[model samples]
Target: MKHSILLVEDEQKIAEGIMDYMNGGEAEYETCFTWADDGDKALELVYENEYDLVLLDIMLPGADGFEICKAIRAKSYVPVIFLTARGREEDRLYGYDIGCDDYVVKPFSMAELSAKIMSFLRRSKGLWEKKSSIEAYDIVIYPDKLQVFVAGNEVRLAPKEYAMLKYFMEHRGMLITRDDLLVRLWGYDYEGSDRVVDNHIKKLRQALGEPGKKIKTVFAKGYRMD
Candidate 1:
């Protein structure tokens, strides 16, 4: 599969070099790259296009890469790699804190960066293949089919309800906030209230019947699949 990558870097030479290396056939898979010299443009591409991975520079002309990464995290789980000159421990920690998949300091080798990108891509593909379907308790979810089975009986779910249930089943024990669900399922452009998440969760639970008992409401927080 040809993976699309967004390269956000201010330095034209550096960006071109990285792009050339990525597409130069050093790896087994083909990588097509789009270059963005400013953070605003980066965010615009991120919102409008679906990229397999993002190669982001920390300091940019408009908004910083950290802010861009946060915005991306709000809507999608696309992998983000910070390629920057800021090599401080705190900077690296902050990158991870803000949801960067990997951080590579400036003056880095293109070969190493290519290897890292390949590794992340392979792992992501493996995970998606492995999670094609999931079973928890008496509930089985076929994500590819958008079908749910409870106690050997198939349950019909609304689009959003199926998405919510699939998210819950995937995260299982993790606490999922309403904001997380809203941004993830409804998109960043959604102007609806957080109560929408509650309404959907209620309907999702009702749809699941007995298996829905595992979906627990956490007071003042969000829902968790026990």
Candidate 2:
């Protein structure tokens, strides 16, 4: 799936380079951008649709990135990263004060920027952790950061997939029926086939890869993680 990002920068060439480099970059998950060269246009697009992430420049045409960030924070929890030439310690702190998920100074490495974007996206979707790590087999779940590791390599999963993994790990060895999953995870109001549980579980297992064998299928019933 493509990660939708909003790039709000005034410089023409820099914006183009970012869009081209990031869109063409080899990422675990692809990234696509909607470019807004000025702050007014950025806010306009922000109001138009929801984005997975926003890359904002501090100095802009209409409202500054900080103002845009404040407006964004007032309504949405989407991850915002400040992309600016300002490298002062105070500036970085203020950006953080205004709910900036990350601060990237200008003339930065595109590869490093790409990594930061992916990390934030993972954090945003991995439920942004709090608790300590939970381990089973070679799979480790860190609720503190909401990160998963398989054989010590970090793995990123969609929110639902992460939830399914956690639930399975928590209820290891128990016969969890599809209906149970539907009610507990998908909610009682979910109007869909119980097969949706299977589909999610399939994706979850695929994410786990070789370690996925830890999640056992219980013929026609649901699943067991042991």
Leading candidate by TM-score? 1
TM-score per candidate: 0.59, 0.56
lDDT of 2 by residue, 1-226 (tens): 7888899999999899888887784565788799998888888888888788899999999989998999888767677889999998668767765667677998899888888777667646434232366677898898658899999999999988897887666545657677667765666556789888888888888899988988888898878887
User: Model 1, which residues run further than 4 Å from truth?
Assistant: 126-226
Give me the overall lDDT of model 2.
0.80
TM-score, prediction 2: 0.56
Clashing pairs in 1: none
lDDT of 1 at 129: 40
lDDT of 1: 0.83
| CA-RMSD of model 1 | 9.2
